[model samples]
Target: MHKRLSELAFGESGTVRYILASRHELNCLGVRVGKHLTMITRQPIKGPVVVAVDGMEVAMGLETAGCVSVEVD
Candidate 1:
């Protein structure tokens, strides 16, 4: 299944298949579909978990929990 990168859980890993953000935002972030990512853990020592994209870390919001669609290997 395909899902947004923002919906994955901590320790959850998956490849980005697509992003529905605005074109301007997409270009600014340099993110695109098919990018592989892995959720490391929540950040701020109490905030949302962190995800890795090409070695870069990104944090996910708690409200958007069901945004990413991942496939387990």
Candidate 2:
């Protein structure tokens, strides 16, 4: 199913479908379409969301995560 990156549960993984914003910035962080991503951690109270992409962990804010679209695996 397609969902926002921020909606992914802890330990869940997915393939990135598309990004709604910050394309350049996110790409620099190794987040791009077709990349496999695993939700490593999600901080509470609207905190950052940490995801593993291509063996590297990247931390992004909740708002940014909300703009990332992914296909659950």
Give every collision pair in model 1.
3-69, 7-68, 16-34, 41-49, 42-48, 42-49
In terms of lDDT, the poorest run of 10 residues in model 2 is: 21-30
For each candidate in turn, the TM-score is 0.54, 0.98
lDDT, model 1: 0.54
What is candidate 2's CA lDDT for residue 5?
Answer: 99
- lDDT per residue, candidate 1, 1-73, as tens digits? 5544444556667765544445344434444556677877755534664667788876556333234444432
Candidate 2 has a TM-score of 0.98
lDDT of each: 0.54, 0.97
Highest lDDT: give the candidate number: 2
